[model samples]
Target: MKTYLAHGTRFEDTALCRFLNDYGHADLDALHASAREEPTRFWAEVEDAVGLTWHRRYHTVCDLSHGPEWPRWFVGGELDLFENLVGRRARATPEQPALIWEGDDGDLRRFSWRELDDAARRLTTALARLGVCPGERIAMYLPMVPETAVVFLAAARLGAIVLPLFSGYGADAVASRLIDSEAMVMVCADGYLRRGKRVDMLGEARSAAAAAPALAHLLVVPRLGTPWAPQASGQWREWDYRSLVAACDPDTGPTIHGTATPLMILYTSGTTGRPKGVVHTHAGFPLKAAQDLLMAFDLNPGDRLAWITDMGWMMGPWLVFGGLLRGATLVFFEGTPDHPTPDRIWQLVGRHRLTHLGLSPTLARLLMAAGDAGLPQPGQLDSLRVFGSTGEPWNDAPWHWLFESVGQGRCPIINYSGGTEIGGGILGCFPGLAQKPCGFAGPIPGMQADVVDAEGTSLLDQDGDEVGELVLRAPWPGMAHGFWRDAARYLDTYWSRFPGLWVHGDWARVDADGHWFIQGRSDDTLKIAGKRVGPAEYESALVAHPLVAEAVAIGVPHPVKGEVATCFVTLADPAAADSADWHAHETALIAHVAGLLGKPLAPARVHRVSALPRTRNGKILRRLVRAVWLGADPGDLGSLENPSALDALRDYRDSLEAVV
Candidate 1:
C-alpha cells in the first residue's frame, strides 16, 4: 500500500500555473513532456519569462556539435547575472525588499533592491581599485550574512570568479582551496556569531592568507572587531571593508562579460583525495537555478524564501539567484535553527512570514528530539506553504514528524535531491503531484534520469525490483563546466562510468507505483551473505526506536560471513545509555532492527556512542567510521566537522580490541 502525505490542488493563480498556461500545459506531465521534447524551446521560454537581459543576443540556443559533454549554451550572448537580478530589477522596483537578514541577537536588517545594487557597485569599485582584474578569482571566507552576498555579486559584477569557502573550515582547509584556485584577492569577516559564541574568523583567514602566495590583497569586513592590524612585512596588504567602500563611488555600472565567462569555482568536499574545484559559468548556473525555483518551487514576486544553509553550500548561491531573479526576497538567518530555543525555526517563519522554507533531515531530527517544549503552537507555522528538504536520505520517523508536526499536514514537503556540481535539483517533487513520504515525484523537467543496472540496462522501465545506479541520459546547463583545469579527472569521475551517461554516485529505485527513492550513496552500500542493503535501511530501523536519537550502520569484516552490519548509535537519553541494563538495551535495539529487516540482514554488533562522524553539511561519514573502526587512516579530514568524534570512535575500537 502507498501512503501519500499530501495531494496536489489546482491553484490556478500560482506562478507555476501561469508558466504552464503560457506553454498550453494544464497538467504537469504535459509540461514535463514539452520540456523533454523541446528543451531549447523550454529554456527559451524560461529566458523570456524570467526577463533575462542579454547585451548581445545569441544566434543559437545550444551548440552540441562539439559534444554533449562540452555543450555551448547561448552562444555569442553577453551579459552578467547581476544585470538581471539587481540592475534592471532595482530600476523597475527600487523600494521592494531584495534581501532580509536577522542575527541570533534579534538584530534585523533589510536591503531594498536599490540599496543592494548600490552596495554591490561600491564593493565592485573597491575591488577594481585593489587591482582585481576581470578574470581573477576572489575567495570569500565569510559567514551567512548580507555582506557575503554583496561581495559575491560585486565579484561577479567585475567579471571575477568567486570561491566561497565554508565558514566552519579551518585555516588549512581555507588554504587548500585558495591554493587550488589561485585566488588573487580574498574577502573575509573578522568574526561571526554561532550558537551564541563568536568564532575567531579573521585570525584564521589571516593565517590562510599568509600561506597562499597568490593572494595579493586581503579585504576584511569588521563583523566582530578589527582584531589584527595590517603589517607591511606581510605578503599581502589588508584594508577595512567600510573604509574601502566609503572611498569608492557607487554610481558605476557592472562590466559586461560573455555568457561563457567563469562565474565561480565551488570545491566539492570529499572523504578522500584532494577536493575538486567545480567551475560554473555566467549563463549556466544562475539560469538553471532560477528556472528550477520558478517552475518547481513556485517562487514568484513578493515571496520570501529561506533555506537554512551556508554561503559555501550550493543552496546558498542557488537561493540568491533563484529568489532574486524572480523578484522574490531572500531571507538569511544566522546561527543554528535550534539555538536559544528549539522552536527558533518556527518563530522565524512566523516572524518573517516566509512562504518557502528548506532544511535538511538531520537538522529536523535534532529538533524533533526537543518535542514541543520550545516549539511554537501549530498555528504559528501557517504562513509556510511549502517545505523543502535535501542533503541526505530521510528516514520515515523524521519525515513524518516534519510533515505532520511542522507542516500540520497542510503543506507539501518538496523532497529535493541534487549536488553542488548540478546547480539545481535533478529530481524534485513538483507542487501539483501526488507525493509519497520521502519519495521524489519524478526527475525535474527536462532531466532524462533513469535507474540502470551494472551493465547500464534500465531497471525501473523494465519493472525490475533490483536497485541500480542513477544516470542522466541528457546534458543540462547547470552541469559544472569541468573540474577547474582538470578535464581528465572530470571525464573519469562522471562520464567514465557509462559511455556518455553521467553516473551519479547514488543508489536509487522505483516501486510499482513509479515513485523514486534514493537509498544511499552507492559506495556506502553493505553486502552481507550475498544480499546488498544500504546502511540507511538499518539506520532507519534503529532510529525508529524511542531511545535512539541517531545511528550510523557500517559494513565490517566478519569471520564467517563475507561482511556484516555494525551500528554506532547515539542515545536520545544519555542517562539511559549508562543504565545497568545497557547490554540488554543494546540487545533490544539489535533485535528491533532484526525484526524490521529479518535475521539475515540483522546487525552483528551495536555500540552506543555520543556522536557519529559527519561532514559540515550534516552527512554521516560512513567511510570515515569504517576506517576508524578498522584502525586505518581516515583520509582527508578537511570536511570532517568534528575531529574529536574520530578520536572517540578510535578509543571505542581500541577498548573493544583490548577485550578481544
Candidate 2:
C-alpha cells in the first residue's frame, strides 16, 4: 500500500479503506452492493468522496425505470459542469493560473481563472453569433494552445457538441469527421509548429471545409498569418480570433446551460470505415473525470499536472476537467515531449516541482533509449509524486525502469487502461492497493470490473486472478451513452459480448494477490495455427532484449500456419541500424522469442525498422503496420504525428518482397 501517488501522507485509514474492509466482499462486489442495495447512499457516498458541489441537491440517486440498458444519470438534477470548472474557481480564486500554455517557439501564455472565464465567454458569444445552437456540432482542429482548450469549454458551455480533430490530420481525414458531425463551423489555426517546422492547418482545414458543405464559418486563428487566406470566406483579409473575441460581449444571452446536454463527440477506431463518434454528456464527463482525478491519483489544489496530448484524444478532456475541477495548475506544452532536448520532460518535472507527472510507456522507452547519458541528476525527478500510464499496455522492463530509474524507485506507476467511450478508466489503480510491476491495481472507485472466460463465466474465486475479457457487470458514471450516430453498433460492439454486461475489448487478468494485468486489445487478437494470442505477449518479449528500444507485433497472412506472428522493432541506437548488426540483434531477439513462446507460434520474422508510426499520443498503430504488410489500405495516416515512418515501413515491406 506504500505510494507516492498520494501527497506523501499515508491514507490507509481513510473512508476509502473503511469501505474496502467493511463490506467483506471484493471491490467490484462491494461497489455493486453499494450501488444496488443502498442506491441513494451509494451516489451520495460517491458525491462526497468526489467533492461534488450541490448547487441544488438531488431527490434520487439511482433511478433506472428502463433498466440498466437505458439508465438515466442524475434524473431531476440541475448541475452545470461549467460552473464546476470555470465559474466556481473564478469566483473564489480569480488570479490562480487555470492554464499554463507554452508554444513550440518557446512563447509562454498563462491564463488566470478570471481570464479563462472572460475568454471562454467571448468565444462562446462569437459561436452564438455564428448561429451555433444548443446540441449543434462545432469541429475543432487545433493544437495544445490556450485557444484550443477555450474553444472546447466554450462549445461545452453553450451546450454545443465539440468535435476535436488532431491538428496534424490532413484534409481528407479532417473532412470525414466534419461531415460526420455535420459541423456548421470549424475552429482552426493558420499554422502550427511540429518538430520546429510550420504546418499550414488553416489552409488544409479550409480545403477540408469545402468538402464539408455543412461548414458555414471557418474561425481561423492566424498564429503565423503569413500568406494564408480562407478558401471560401474572402470577406476578411486576415482572421484574428482575438478581434472576434474583442467585438463580442462577455455576457452572451444568459448561457444556454444544462447538465445532460450533449458536450462532445470523440471518435474511436472502428473495425472498418471512419472511427465511430462516441457522445458524452456534460454532467457525467467533467464530474466523473474529476472524481477519477481525485480518487486515482489523489490530485490536490497545488499539484501541477501535465501529460503530452492533443485535444483530439480523450486525455485532452480528461486532463482539462481533472486538473481544473480540483484546483490543480495544468502545464500545457504545445510541443513535443522530446522537443529541444530529450531531457525537456525531466527539466519540466524539476522546474515546475511537478507533483503528478503523467507519461506513456512509449515515451519512457524513447527517453530511456535516448540514453540517460543525456539525462539530469537523479534528484531532478524528486518533485515527481506519481507517474501515470495510459493508451497502451506497459512492458515490465519499462515499468520497472520507470519505477526505479525515472522515479528513482520512489514513485508508483499507475497503469490506467480505458477507452474513449468510457471517458475515464473502467479499470485503474487507487495506489492504496498492492501493485505488481506492469500490472493495474484494480478497477476505479465506482467501476465494477471482472475478468471472465470466453463463455462469460467467472474465472476466479474470491481474490481470483486469471486471464479473461475485462468486463463491467454494473454501470459507472464514466461510461458513454453510445456511439454518436451508431447506437446499435455500440450495443453490438460492447454489450453483445455478454448479457447486460459491458465487455471492454481487452484481454485482462488478475493474479491470486489481486494484481491486474492488461494483455492487449481483444480486437487485435492473433491466431497462430488456431491458437489465440495477444500481440502484447510477443512485443513484450521482444522489448525485453537489451538492444530493442520498441517493438510491435502483428498477425501476418501465412500460407501454412494461416497467420504467423510478425514483429517490427526499433533498436536502442541508430548505430545498430546496419542490417548486419540489426540482423544479429534480431537473431538473438528471435531466439529469445522462440524460447519464450515455443515453435509453431514463435515469430515468423523479426524485422528492424527505423521507427514505428504512432499517434500524437504515442500509441503504436499496429493495425496500420499489418495493413501495409498485407498491401491493404492503412485507413487514416493523418492522425499520425510521424507520417514518414509509414514510408520507411513501406520501404522495409518492399525489401521483404525483394527476396520473395
RMSD of 1: 1.8
Off by over 4 Å in 2: 1-9, 13-40, 54-56, 225-239, 252-256, 462-465, 528-531, 581-584, 598-601
lDDT of each: 0.84, 0.76
**How well is each residue in 297-377 modelled by candidate 2, as lDDT tens digits?**
767776789888888888987898767877888888777778888887777778667778777889888777777743557
Model 1 clash pairs? none
Candidate 2 colliding pairs: 465-510
lDDT of 1 by residue, 1-660 (tens): 355545333456556778888877867778777777987887788788777888888888888897778889888998867888788878988998899998877778899999999999999888888888888999998888898789878988888999988888899989989998999988898888877888888789888988899999888887776466765635888888888898899847556788889999988876567789999998888888888887778777888999988888898888887777888889999877887888888888999899899988888888888887545676777777788888888888888898877676767788888898888888887675577877888888777888998899889768455788989887887888999999999888889988888888888888787788888888888887787788888888998999899999889988889899999988888787675778998899989999999988989898988788876557677888888998777776766778899889889888888999
